[model samples]
Target: MTHKKLILHVSLATLSGLMIFAPVATIPAQASSVKPSSAMLKKSNSYYKKHYKAIAKKYKFTYSAQTGLNKSGTIYVYEKTKSSYLKKSLSLAMNYWNSKLGRQAIKVGSKKYHTVTFSVSNAKASKSDDSDAWWIPSTKKVQIRNSLYADDLSVITNTTLYNSEKSLVKTANANLAAYKAGLSTTDPDYQSKLDTYQQQQVDYAKAAFDNQESNLKSGLAIKAREFEYANTLAHEFGHVMGLKHSPNKSDLMYWASGTNDIYNYNKVKNSSKGFSLVTSTDVARAKLAVKVHNARN
Candidate 1:
């Protein structure tokens, strides 16, 4: 299969009050037959063919020494489940990467989709972090939870909007502190000012809360099926490719959307043709990773 060069355009606002937009980069096509190590391919292909006839028939199984990641060497898609949205979501995610990289080694298998549940570690297990998907480094396998869906991402998006609104309220409260301190029982307009300020805070908080709910119901509902699901799927796969989390929020490798709230909202706003746009930083790192592997070998 032929693949076009990956190109990404990004805008950056500099400290000097100038917005700098990076030029689009066109990377040349790589050779088609960059095969993976035979030993790993033999084992992975055997596992797929023995258990998943559908997968064996559909995808080419190969390994890539350039990536130093055996997982991407062969793409194994679990059988389609009863949930059609989920099946489509997974397919879109897989296709997004494959088309961009020109890697068509995919296999559709009958193996049940994988899931990871968090069991209480001990008596003091009040806090638990459950993952929808994970990439196991040792085994080089990507495990996707059974509950993956488009609407599920609303939790994160809503939380971010909620926090941004809270930040606004906090700032308003800080501004009111001086006015509150100067108040006295003798003052005529003191009560009215206090009442107005309090009302303003209340109104601000309510507005923020309402926007959060509205965005979740409206914006996220539409985006989840289109770009968000594809973005999420690609993020998980980046981990499987041995990529560490990137500091840049726009990059697929960024793991902490909650802490960097504004970027989460911006991501939903700036999606490319039914999917999140992969940034130049992501492509550069991926190339560097492959280059590093080649240099070492």
Candidate 2:
């Protein structure tokens, strides 16, 4: 055999091995440095330190009708008397989780925040109406109503708001005192429990996906388009809450879903919808109805 032929054969074998076992890249070491914003940092530090003041409170993730608005927190879904679309969506999701979806994890805010979804009647059904921007204050963090909305916007780790959460949040923390007392990160039981917990989350997501078809076919698709904020909802609830869009192209939050799907926009019907959070560019052209209760004088 020629030396050149032998070299080609070796290359093919190496390529085959790589195809069989693709290597995983290490998660970036400076992952924390991907700071959302500098203003967010300064505002968050001052807000948390001042209001929470040495709060060792821990949050837990659980399936409860009490999602987002916990016993200690507040989240209200309201519709103004005038906007029909806003009324419909709020009415649609009012008690949506009384069944299976209720079994899924939900975002929970701290006790301080009076979490609310004030659906304005004159405001139309637009989720981007200027009114809703209060939920996600732009660069200005101090103006945020509570620390939960401003600082503790659920990002990386999903925590539950249960009684046993104090230790749950600290479970990931490598406390020297616990290590010195004999607790080890390598304990089989600890590893096993963590694996089961993570697997449960994946399983729950799979179940959620299974219902996606039905959800899309039903009132949700109409609501999703009429409101024109499915992307915002998915981005806010899923990504901000630590879930990524599946590799599948069908999900609305797909990284590449931006080019405007041929199916969604073509058939989306227009309704009596207004905006709660308008894009910065839109704020100049259209006047949105901000809720009377929440209006800034």
Candidate 3:
């Protein structure tokens, strides 16, 4: 008898896979001319030299002094995407950082001064699965996946639901001891009671997950998409400013697309206080990077 060959196929999907491309470029040698001097630059350099490691430890983002700024203390950004909406998004990101740093450290300019280039394309090219955008440190380029603009919101919805379920599972696991406190394995009905209790927990979790998913898919759907795009752009811009992934879930530079950040933005987008997508730590780090770059140049 001949046996047929067996085959198996597996598929995996993710919400967002924003990543920083490798091969970090070396910092060029500084010119022999007089080093630029300013009060903010001096303070930034002093603060960074003293507390960067502590800041990194606290904020969980890798530090680098790789600013794309020119000798005039401006990093020119060229928008090759040619989309007004994207331009606006880029402006928002630039303005947010400038406001935080109290300087025009970044600018929109011609290709000659364009150390940082922004573009949008539908082609996946070298991107990984579910990647929304990426930053190349070596070339200082950012490419946003155009497909995200027209996405159906299913990805964000599913990720939100999955996170909710995972949180519920964690809570259940933590309460397992309490769940078995009054039950004895020697009793004939113990297994049934335990199973019923577990099932009730599962049912409650399911209901909560369903409610969150529904809310995300309905009233918050559009805002969710908008937040994702804006956050992704800002996150890539963070990379441009020499910041790596942040471990804090609420930060825009968080490793993935930051569903928590997205949720927070949606909640406070219309608030009087407004939402700060970039955390204080992010601002501090970027300011240090700019100061270092300027000092060196």
Candidate 4:
């Protein structure tokens, strides 16, 4: 998810110059791995509070550290959409963060911590053309374009294709077995027939493997797009939790949307290998944000 800088010539003061906050410093990999001392954590919290408050004051926006999380440290989100599809996507996004952090960092509903609201609509022409979702800090709203919804048709198609492939594999194996069992070793051409059948089977097996591999890759791609949508929602939620864009493009907090990082499961950089939705740096920053908020209140 990327924030679109919108300039409005309206009388509504709060929405006049709506923009996202500036990028924060990227956490080093080693720093994220080592637990910080209380002194260091306090220093970091002071810096974050000063930085965020400065930005909000300069921009005439409200900055409330007391809003997004409860004292129990869970972020409760509410979705304001009637569509079950969008609701499920938000649920998946929240689950992604909670799993990565290994705790109940985000819950689906509770007005006590409803500092974040998720909603969906068609892409507005006023917003940037490339953005799939945007988050407004002052309003505590995350808006996702309806186009980002997963394709139900693709899922059905993949399932049908899988069943067809399974049936074909079973039939092929049975036919090959039947052909081999019916062969008569007493015939003069028995050896030639056996050799030919063996060769045909080898060829068929290789062809089938290749086809299945191709189909598997295609199916994985569809799944990846679905994951990307959920990842985008999670990315927006990251903003609500006080995370800024990362300099590392592989990170979930990166500024751009639709980089297709989920497709590369191998976690290789500069390749088709997939990476995790949230890096350790993102988790560390989110946890730190929670601590800062808790300390502030």
Best by TM-score: 3
* Poorest stretch of ten by lDDT in candidate 3: 1-10
User: What digit string (tens of lDDT, one per residue) describes model 3 on residues 46-81?
Assistant: 565666555444433344425455665566888887
Error (Å) of candidate 4 at residue 150 is 7.1
Off by over 4 Å in 4: 1-39, 42-67, 71-73, 82-85, 110-113, 125-129, 148-222, 257-275
The TM-score obtained by model 1 is: 0.41
Give one clash count per candidate, in the order shown.
Answer: 3, 19, 0, 4
Instruction: State the lDDT of candidate 1 residue by residue for 1-297, as single tens digits.
Output: 001111111122211121111112221222232222433233443354454323212222111312314333444555334655545556666676666655653344445532211111122211132334444444434444444333245544544465556666787788678669878867898889899987887787788667756775675545544454455556555544434545555556554321132224545556444554455555544443333333333
Which of the two candidates, 1 or 4, achieves a greater lDDT against the reference?
A: 4
Q: Judged by lDDT against the true structure, how good is candidate 1?
A: 0.44
Model 3 ranges with Cα > 4 A deviation: 1-67, 111-113, 125-130, 152-224, 257-274
Per-model lDDT: 0.44, 0.27, 0.58, 0.56
| Per-residue lDDT over 10-109 for candidate 2, one digit per residue giving the tens place of the 0 to 100 score | 2122311111110121111221212123332234433534533122111111111122232322233332235454345333323222121233223322
Candidate 4 colliding pairs: 264-273, 264-274, 265-274, 266-274
Name the Cα RMSD for model 4.
12.0
* lDDT score, candidate 4: 0.56
lDDT of 4 by residue, 1-297 (tens): 254322222223232333333323223222122222444345665575666554333222222422555666677788788865456556777877988878988887755547577777676434325355767665666886565343332432343344445655676678777887898878899879877886776678568656644654565444444455566788877777766555555567765533423423322123231333677767766666666665555
Candidate closer to the true structure by lDDT (higher is better), 1 or 3? 3
Cα distance off (Å), candidate 2, residue 168: 58
